[model samples]
Target: NVYADSIEWMSRHLNHRENVILSLHPHNDRGTAVAAAELGYMAGADRIEGCLFGNGERTGNVDLVALGVNLFTQGIDPQIDFSDIDQVKRTAEYCNQLPVPERSPWAGDLVFTAFSGSHQDAIKKGFEAMDARAAAEGVSVDELEWAVPYLPIDPKDLGRSYEAVIRVNSQSGKGGVAYLLKTDHAIDLPRRLQIEFSGVVQSTTDAEGGEVTSDQIWAIFTDEYLPSQVADERWGRFELLGTRTSSDMTGDVELHARLRDGDDVEDTTGHGNGPIAAFLEIVRGRGFDISLYDYVEHTLSAGGDAQAAAYVELQIDGERLWGVGIDGDISTASLKAIVSGVNRAIRTRQLESRLAAV
Candidate 1:
């Protein structure tokens, strides 16, 4: 209010001045320097002078970066080049020897990140929709109106990528995990599989009591779902050799599979309503009790050789688990998903036995 009254008095006194610049120099004594500067501008001040990042005597001057970015977000051009804010922040930190707060407005490390479940979901959907709209309109993403949830301005506008926009910790949910996988690895998980994997991520983060990086998340995913390496022997008990399917005139599907259990190899066949059902019958005949609870599949890319990803949820004994598989063929991907699930179930049993022994 004092700044406003001063600006009003100055404007009235300088009415007849031919060449005078009414400037504002606000201090941070009350932590209202930015507000005073803006209000002074509205009250007919022609110029604003402040230190960068609010660094000055007392509480420091108004932050020019924050003030300019705030105006830019409101569709007003502040005529400042802040596209590479990281560079600006680095230079400021080096010269001033003061660390920027992680939660500082518009310029902090965690400013654009969302850790909550609902916020992650909304941001994930918003990015997907925005990309789709840009593709449909045949324009660059920057040309479109920025309307993502929880983000006042697009990170790309500030020379930042979406990689760090949604980080996962114990507080995160399924959507955050799915968003990370999709953005980093081009693996779009099914909703149910996301829910299943969120539990795994939660346990990992809880045990570690920290943020889980993308590499660690990928390792966990591969350990649970993908084909194991030489170090992982617990899941290679049963290896699939080949598979063929046929349908009779009565529409009964018969599936033939060549399998290897340890050093022994055999060919087995079963009949049911579909390939999955027939395969389950064959596995049932081999003394493993498994039931398929849910299934989802999608193409991994938009090209001719694009891979297909399949997710399978299985119930073994009383435990429920999910597995993922990727291949060039959709059918093969689905079959591999089932095999992955069976291996995971076997691994779970082995772990359980070890715990019981201990």
Candidate 2:
């Protein structure tokens, strides 16, 4: 039930037939803004005003994208082309200098994804059927596809690009890897590779005990398949060593790693696709569930294994988090980063739990 005594008072004062643009700034501190907004919308309020990312001084305001998306989903024309939501999100992030977390409500990287094997299987079948139907009708697959098992709404409806669909790393199971391999390399890895890669990912994640991101998945893949070469322009070095070692059926391994920054040395092991993958796996084994939402690295000095700094965003129980790692070895730097990310996740979870108990 909505408590709209304040809004009711304002509604009584307004001209009954006036086309009012409802301007609402809700503080999530009480978790009642959304209900209030919904009541107002149903009460015939037009042109609702809200903050872009729910950002403000206190517990934030109503999320405009959320309100707009709701309207679009309800068959009401929101006066915006939501078909390219990815582009819209990009513009917002750039204009506001904001980072969209991996687990944000509508725009997060993992928002439309599924991790469980059963859910992935269902989504895969749904996409396949959507493709077949669209082909039979001679229409665009985009038009036929609905938000399947994992996604709430068609990503295309929000203008998301196909390129944003991600796979790899540990959190991803078979379906994600299949999508990535087909999209990027034009070569579908065998079921064995899928299982092997899943194990590589799972072991790493279980060790860290948290979520992983697409960019980090790519970094792990680079270390596994192309160790001598960097994963991407951003990655520094591709190497993994285990203070404590374990192996998978594919002969990939995880290692416990110790990294040093100046006089401060952080001991955190991580897993990878192979031994490098194992490094991250071992870290996951230590109880960190880190996922790399996005990362950026820049060379600070001359060539020949120059120093690289890594930035990563992590999600734990729906809250977004970030961490940084800097070193000469890009792989180590990334791993150390994610370790810092796990620390943040743990800290956040602890604080949240303490607050809840109070």
How accurate locally is residue 202 in candidate 1, as Cα lDDT from 0 to 100? 94
Cα lDDT of model 2 by residue, 44-80, tens digit: 4554566765655586677777777777767778786
The C-alpha TM-scores of every prediction are 0.89, 0.49
Candidate 2 lands at a TM-score of: 0.49
The global Cα lDDT (0 to 1) of model 1 is 0.86
Best by lDDT: 1
Provide the global lDDT of candidate 2 against the true structure: 0.59
Window of ten residues with lowest summed lDDT in model 2: 233-242
Residue runs of model 2 more than 4 Å from their true location after superposition: 4-25, 83-100, 113-118, 186-197, 200-358
The per-candidate count of clashes, in order, stands at 0, 50
- Lowest lDDT block of 10, candidate 1: 231-240
